[model samples]
Target: MNRAVRIGVQIQPQHADYKQIRQAVADAEETGVDIIFNWDHFFPLSGDADGKHFECWTMLGAWAEATSRVEIGALVSCNSYRNPDLLADMARTVDHISGGRLILGIGGGWFQRDYDEYGYEFGTPGTRLADLAQALPRIRARWEKLNPQPLRDIPILIGGGGEKKTLRLVAEHANIWHSFSDAATLARKSAILADHCADVGTDPAHIERSTGVRALQGSSPDDVVGDVLDAGATMFTIGVSGPSYDLGPVREWVAWRDEYNARQG
Candidate 1:
């Protein structure tokens, strides 16, 4: 299927007060983003090391209530933080609260600080990926047995670029696959993902390709967005930080999405 181009914004839930974050979310929805995402991290990924930060799922619950239009989720939730069944239940609850707008974007844990401060074992990358491999099935099964069940199917978005394991998992399970790849890298990895999908008897087109694009310093969206589209990504995401939470670039990308979707149509 030829999916329509979509725009998403990751409102970094750090370095600002909740009020500021809430305003950003409102602004993003009002400005016409299709999806709103926040990262699942205990600390700031940028700026000061000891900056103000908030927990992921709780804020998602709030976003579920705060906005009525855009789909909300973590850019990628860490599989190591909570048990798979519990996480599935949490996602189901959020999906209900949002009236069916939750996207369960998850990944194998990566940040060491999160694990260290939270008392989770800082396991090796191989072990972490293995754990994620084990968790996906349990999460799906839990979703099936939940009392009320998710409001919808709860789109599963897996974020990572590991060609061997992560991409394979995405091929096997994800409704959406997200990565931070340039056009060339996206093309290569996408081909690899297609091969993985073929091996697993999945139609590669069944998974939406999503990637993060930086709002270039003083450049038009046309400069980079077209290249990414050519690389086969239908979902484009931009990361906007808090405090100011500039939406100028977001607006531009939204316009670009409209134009692109029109052309596709």
Candidate 2:
């Protein structure tokens, strides 16, 4: 089936109290976003390096109870932080809490500080990718062995743009492949992903194309975002940071998504 155009809001859990982050999630859902995401990290990705930050999966568990409509998850959880089986169980539990609205967005670990402070091995990039490759199947296996199974088959959303191992893993495993690329780069990488999909005998279209977008004030998002749509992307996400966690851009993107989907229909 052709994927619908959707908007996701990544409410970055940095420099803000849990109260404010929770409110931002409420506001994002109220604004009609299809998904609400938080990043997986031990510390802030931007602004004040030592800023207040929340852990990823625990926040997702809270979001599952707090939200009723929008899908909730980490924008991409780091694979190195938890055991594959444990992560699978966590995702399954959250799926049940959300009544099956979880998207397990995961990626090979980055952010050395997270590893250093958390005491996980700060492995090389190749090692990290290899670990991710090994973990995906184990996670699926554990999901099957879980007492109740998942509420449904929780969708796997893999995030990254590496042409080598990452794209290959997306072909083998991901239901959604999220990329951080400009329109031109997205187009190129997408073709590469398709080739990888072909090698794995998975339909490229079956893997929903996802990418991050920045909403500029007074700008018509269609030109930039439409170019990405033309490149086969359908799920567009915009990140909103805290202390304040503004949802104005999320509202704008949700409006665009509705209009875009309506026009497509």
Clashes of each: 0, 0
lDDT of 1 by residue, 91-139 (tens): 9999999999999999998999999999999898889999999999999
Candidate 2 Cα deviation (angstroms), residue 26: 0.7
Q: How do the predictions measure up, each by TM-score?
A: 0.98, 0.98
lDDT of 2 by residue, 1-265 (tens): 6678989999999999999998998989999999999999989999999999999999999999999999988889999999999999999999999999999999998899999988999889999999999999999999999999998889999999899999999999999999878778988998998899899899987889899998888886686585778778889898989898878877878888888788888
Name the 10 consecutive residues with the lowest summed lDDT in model 2: 220-229
TM value for model 2: 0.98
